[model samples]
Target: MEERVKIIEERSLSEGWFNLKEVIYDYTWFNGRVQRQSREVAKKGNYAGILLYNKEKRTVILTRQFRMPSYLNDTSDGFIVEACAGMLDDDAPEECAKREALEETGFKVKNIEKAFEAYTSPGTLSELAHLYVGAYEDDMKVSKGGGADEDEDIEVLEISFTQALEMIKTGEIKDAKTIMLLQYAQINELLN
Candidate 1:
């Protein structure tokens, strides 16, 4: 068996709206006998969230916003097309999803359903995403989307099930989370 690097020390690199940490890994994996005895060790985190669906309208709710990462990387839709999701700040996945939906869409979620939970980028970062679908009620749209403090310029989109599928096929919906939500809806017959 290959030896692995053991974390001996971890320091809070930064914490504010988000948290980052610096860690020390004992490089035993490299020091062990034979070059074959080596393995990588690291610390990571995940982005947990949920996806909302509206069975009554046969529509799915998505958010369109400028993504700095996508902009920098030259990815299409620097204005991203994604499911309503947010970072899980010490809360249960469903609770976080509900809070995010209300915050991002200014709409209330009813009969929220759990779709799935996944790692956005497991090999590199520890960003666990919780997927969810809630029945969307448009009659309850209150306030304008999201909070201003986060500097979030969000636009809400409501599309019929077929339209959503077309967007996905044409790569119009490029965000992974959004694609997953659409898939869940399709598989469950929440969408035609």
Candidate 2:
């Protein structure tokens, strides 16, 4: 299929936070017809996300913060409750997940299990998210995590597993990665 799509040209549109590029390409259809198409793609590095749970407590750790995109998209407030996640930076996926859990939720999680990988937004965003689920305990709390970055103002929340599921139904938890991870925990009986 590499021969089916040929990139004719790529122009950088923005290189600020992430990269945005305008690409012109030729697509050869299965019927032997070629069509030229143009699209704008956002190129950000891949990310790792983790749903921290405690089987004994039947609770999960989550984070809340303002999301500019969600605010622009008509959300009443930009704040979103989501699984702990961040760009992979230079670390491996599992390492990134563990690091993010600690940085965002104050949990130094051990016994983390790999959940799955998915493209967060394939149409425009170019980042594959590595998702995981982990067991956490009171002893895992090392600090009052609000994010390590100066730009991050994360509020950590620990809620019951059942309540988390209810939040999903109420649309209080709208982030895709968080919902997927929570559903995974429920389907797998991870908190039970």
Candidate 3:
């Protein structure tokens, strides 16, 4: 088969914390017809997320924070429960996950198990997320993590693994990365 997509033009629409571009391309159909298509894509780059679990306590450390996008969409207050995550920002995915874990949840994660990588929203966003699971203990608390400086206002929560799983069904845990990690823990019996 021949190459499917051919880029015609790409124009930047916005460039700030992230870049947004409008692209025109030619896509070859399965029937051998070429179709011109245009799409606007937001390029926020890749990120890493970690789910911190404590085997002895059968608990997980999570964070809740106000998310502008989620607030503008479906959430009334815009606060969401999610795993510790941050942009890779030139660092390795595992390192980013570890840093975010400590900065957002006060847990200094040491051994991270790479679970999987996924595109959060492939249709219009160019963000690939690296996922990880890390074991934590009570002694791992290193700081009163509420994010660094004035960049984030995060509330850390330590909840039982069973309750966290139940939150998934109750619509309390809506973040995709968090959901995936919780499911991974269940399937792998990480706490047991």
Candidate 4:
């Protein structure tokens, strides 16, 4: 793999919420041709996302919050309904998922099952998303979870699983991770 690609240079473009770097690399094609390319990449730590569903009630817990990028991309108000997720700081992926569930949806989820891992945006983002599904009950709600960060203003939503699936068709749910998790549940019959 190292022989396939060589890093020519790398420079930092910005560093805040995440580090952005401009990279120049030399890549050898399968036919043995070499080409130099440059690209800017956002380097964020891996994240853990969890879809909380209640099997008995056929409901899911989600969060709605304003996303600046979505707003810039032409969403009416930038508010996106998504599963509970967050970057894995120092915690293990499972711990991070549970923490995010508590912080974003006020559900102390237990017995989460790992679904799969995926890259959020392979071309631009260097983040591997660790996705999971967990069962939740009303008694697990300890607080009005609206995120621990000061900049976060999240609204917790407990909507029917059927309604969530409908939102995907209606384009009301546009977040990739959320959609993927929901589809996974449907395919795996987690709510049935």
> For candidate 2, lDDT tens digit of each residue in 20-130?
999999999999899999999999999999999988999999999999989998854899999999999899999999999989998998788899999978999999999
Looking at model 3, residue 64 earns an lDDT score of 96
Once model 3 is optimally superposed onto the true structure by TM-score, how far is the C-alpha of residue 152 displaced, in angstroms?
A: 0.7
Candidate 4: give its CA RMSD in angstroms. 1.1
Regarding lDDT, does 1 or 3 come out ahead?
A: 3
Residue runs of model 1 more than 4 Å from their true location after superposition = 1-5, 8-46, 148-150
32 Cα displacement, candidate 1 (Å): 12
lDDT of each: 0.72, 0.94, 0.93, 0.95
C-alpha lDDT of candidate 3 relative to the true structure: 0.93
Segments in model 3 whose C-alpha atoms lie over 4 Å from true places:
none
lDDT of 3 by residue, 4-39 (tens): 999999999999877999999999999999999999
Task: Rate residue 2 of model 2 by lDDT.
Answer: 49
- Clash totals, every prediction: 9, 0, 0, 0
Global lDDT of model 1: 0.72
Angstrom error at residue 175, model 3: 0.6
Where does candidate 1 clash, by residue pair? 45-126, 45-127, 46-126, 46-127, 46-128, 47-127, 47-128, 49-130, 51-132
